[model samples]
Target: MILSGMATPTRRSVLALGLLGCALPGQAEEPIRILTEEYPPFNYTDKGKITGLGTEVVQAVLKEINLDAPFQSLPWARAYETAQSTENVLLYSLNRSKEREKLFKWVGQITPTDFYLFSLKSRNLHINSLEDAKSQNLQIGTVNQDIGEQFLASQGFAVGRNLQSSAKYELNYEKLKLGRVDLWVMNELGAYYMSRQAGDDPAVVLQKALRIPELSGGGNHMAFGLKTSDAVVERFRKGLETIKKNGVYDALQRKWL
Candidate 1:
């Protein structure tokens, strides 16, 4: 019989399982390979370790399901391709798009990310609506091949040149501060974290949080992508349900952000 209302495991469980996997035999352990681009406070390489909110959240989910796994920082496009083609592979913090609805299974609503438009605080920029951005010579900076890039391109916004798709978002934040770009576009949580890494300088501020009415609830619900395996997706879904009920996710969010 299936267990009902199993509470999601915590970080301690992840360490325990990883250790157990090493100690056992004939019981092959599968690692949950995650693809991620540098988006600070979410995923970043520091001192030879990949640690961030995104990493932590995925880890917590794995622990809940008693899975032994690890994540790697990869090029965003490569990561997405890998997740689509490989088994047990997953991508995190991905914007749920209709184009990709059938590509993979999902886990975690993760966090509420509000996309916004930002500029230097000193600049006298007034954005009452998204159309206001059209009149000004605004060049929005976003990662290469990201949903933001696709959104801007589709709108014929002629945003600035695409920036490098690094796992770190601070690079783009710095670029915005340097006047290399007139405006920066990204999810709210990402912008907040990037700004913290950028320091409490008075020069940066979000002018307007433009929402897309067409997207799911005017925002994207991020999820972990898995190969289209019935067993694996079911397992992950159950694990995620438990985590949501157990407050495991809430604690991690408080610790990381």
Candidate 2:
């Protein structure tokens, strides 16, 4: 409050006092939080360290931006929630779906992935469409809040009925092999990558039962939360563009993909 005899400060006076530059006494910018999940080749934990295709691409982008934010691997659901609601938070390898287009400020694409519903060749699941899979009373495995899970939910699939959600993809992978889950919805590259990680020959064991066109193509992206400034978002966007233009992106693809 102003004093009894004090006059209201004019715009020029406020600027002169440097009040415009610092809106509040201690309102400093929040620390940057870069988060990802264990989706593999894109981003995953490896032998007590975090590194992958998407992780490395993001690092290159950060280098171009001259920003020093480390990546943290979290559960998919938690990472999604935190990236949506928190300020100065960046998440990568995110599917730039129409349902999520306006949720955050997009940076740029990482790498392309073909999404599919995979099942064991032993089961010989004859799934050709979403309806076909649902009609058969097949249990579909998914990671909670993952893009595949969310897409199915939007199409009226609900939990405990036909959709089975897990915190990790490994659980779903194991379940699918054990006949616990009739189908596993995942990207083709990730499905094979994960199968190899589990010491199985994906080509021999897993079959791509159905292709999801909407969820495929156009690759994934690095995105900032809504609370972030457009200026910061643009800076990071330019960084991604820089890496893609300078041959760094191609190098990463060859290294990890």
Note the residue pairs that clash in candidate 2. Answer: none
Which lDDT value does model 1 have at 257?
Answer: 59
Q: What C-alpha lDDT does candidate 1 achieve relative to the native structure?
A: 0.65
Off by over 4 Å in 2: 1-30
Q: Residue 246 deviation, candidate 1, in Å?
A: 1.6
- Per-residue alpha-carbon lDDT of candidate 2 for residues 166-213, written as tens digits (9 for 90 to 100): 998888999999999899999888899989989999989999899999
Best by TM-score: 2
Query: Model-by-model lDDT, in order?
Result: 0.65, 0.86
